[model samples]
Target: MTSTADSYFVCATPRTGSSLLLGLLESTGVAGRPQAYFREPGEPMWAGRWGLPSTAGYDEYVRAALAAGRTDNGVFGAKLMWGTLDLVVDRLGAVHPGLAGHDVELLERAFGRTRFVYLWRDDVLAQAVSWLRAEQTRLWEADGEAEPGGHAPGYDAAGIEELVERIGEHNAAWERWFASCGVQPHRVRYEDLDADQTGVTRGILAFLGLDLPEGRKIAPSHRRQSDELNAAWIERYSRESARS
Candidate 1:
């Protein structure tokens, strides 16, 4: 059996119920979400906090915690959404192209001690459309009212397509990087989690080496559709379903 000293890394794409997973972990006191990066308790932003490291970087942060010598419990875990794979990989490549090669040596050297949790959504096309609508909603809400430029500003047909491609490329690169690292990550399907809570939660617990509290329910929100008659705007944007 892997010792309790083993740590964990939850690596996943955005919109994969990572927040709910993290929330469940938090309740156990065995794992914690990074306060500085995760920001407020429940607000979910894809990369705003999760991708931004402290001055020392992500691996350094985990290393520091380990160095603190506080292991009364078992492993410590943190999440990094896979949507950030491209952004981080590209940046690493610019500094040292070799780092992007087999094993992502730079990253592994920093975080290989962690057991990885890889989360993916099956309906990737729908995920992209959902992201577009969310972004548009944010812009509209930020304006404190409706602007004259339709549902979303500057996000036309071409823009949506680009976003979809970007997300797809990021997902591909994420799988590739982990494979090259020789890391057999624990894979979690978003649809499965939604459909079978008992099974998905058990899988996650088994991977993390943790037990669940009795009567705890695992409910993850993957669908963003609103059912009210007054939610026409949200419906229109989400149901557009025009891939890019």
Candidate 2:
């Protein structure tokens, strides 16, 4: 049976302000909790937290996901990266019937008239720097979850350069996928979201056909991870990139 819940997906890349957007969306209390449900590295951790066996089959996993991921307003949201899109779709189809074919067909079958949100960063250099720093520090989120006393590694020029190329490739892949699917997603830029989170959040809610609750306050649960170090790295990388 097809679920009657409203469904949406955030097509994003790393260091693209997706976490911040997700935090803002969840704060609404009406918008569903959007997250990386099938991210390979995070799947085991999530399964444990959800009280499922690490080796649980696709059907079991998806059932738990539907149970835990849906919000009170019957909205189901998820964030997807281009790299894992095929794998996630394949697994979802294996467990959930009618989602077993092409990308657009699967999405339509599984979610039934789903909405798409495309989130991206225009500053590739800054995006690469943030991405590299997070990899070095293993501090993906600024929510006080990072292990204390780990020395923040110095920036490596080569690493940042490599990441820049990779991030660009991933962003291009997202664009190609959208074009192939013939979908026009609601776009949200990282800079715009960072500049005015509340306004952007409201815009997203309106796009999703959700009304903000009266007298409710929305705030981000996580802080920006960029700092002085990010600025320095970006500057250095820009100079190096310019020379090469």
Which candidate number maximizes lDDT? 2
lDDT for 101 in candidate 1 is 52
Return the clash pairs for model 2, or none: none
Cα lDDT of candidate 1 equals 0.53
lDDT of 2 by residue, 1-244 (tens): 2333378889999999999998899888877888898788778877888999867897677667666778887888888987888887787677656557678777666665688899999998899889888877778898856644555768899898898899889989989988998888889999999999999998888888888889878899989888898998888878877898
lDDT per model, in order? 0.53, 0.83
- TM-score per candidate, in order? 0.60, 0.90
TM-score of 2: 0.90
Residue 123 in candidate 1, Cα distance off native in Å? 0.9
Residue runs of model 2 more than 4 Å from their true location after superposition: 1-5, 96-99, 147-151
